[model samples]
Target: MKCLIKECDSYDKNQQWDIVCDNLWKLPLSQSVLMIGVLLGNLFFGSFSDRYGRKALFNFAPIICFTSSFLTSFAPNIYVFTILTAITAACIVGMSQASFIIGRIEFIGNKYRVLCVNLQEIVYSLGTVIPGIGSMADIQRTDQ
Candidate 1:
């Protein structure tokens, strides 16, 4: 369990992560866990929201997203990071697809609901791209 390879500016072995996630094999599993969490999120939060009301669920999405995202960043080990990542991924669905969609569609008239959904897609597309752009910029900055 030794990384005899030399370290670089982007990755210093002494500072890099250890204890449960020191290799690439677990990355795909972590990703799968995150994706699978969406199903669990929908199942759990969907019904919970039904009991509590979609508006309330939507309102909590920001807090859940922020808390999970923040905590995930601070995870000291791979297992903790993976679990928090799944929670964050789950909350992404709970916040947007399940809860907000339910709330917004309910608020809109049936006739205009289609338009609302379409607009939501536009926003979602932007959301997906903006992060990629930010990541690209970050890489470029780091390379500089």
Candidate 2:
């Protein structure tokens, strides 16, 4: 139970379901759904791209990702937020791995392909790390 936890916030203490979801434990379920979406997106898009052409899927994937992300911000409840996040995750995984390689490699000259790939890796790494860095900064600021 949340009461057993050492750091239950007011959200947990007051039993506030009118303002937010009562179940904080649903985070893992939401994350699992998001990963499932990612897996499905990769398999579906990988095959779909092969069948329909990578270019179309390459151009379209970001739109799907963006739309889901945009909708997620306005979600009225945890269920909608979770589903939208899952969709966003799916599109992101599919587009990042599948479309990125196909589109990036084909557009650039042979001489610049390696450089492009390297840049992509650098950008991806930064994207992954920035969140952790931001979280650390936020924690430090709050501690002050």
lDDT, candidate 2, 1-144, per-residue tens: 224434454663224323234466676777889889989888988887778777778788889988999998787776787899989988888777665766788789999999998998899999999999888784633553
TM-score, one value per model: 0.62, 0.58
Q: Which sections of candidate 1 miss by over 4 Å?
A: 1-3, 7-15, 18-22, 98-104, 112-144
lDDT of each: 0.76, 0.77
Kindly provide the TM-score of model 1 when superposed on the true structure, using C-alpha atoms.
Answer: 0.62
| Global Cα lDDT for candidate 2 | 0.77
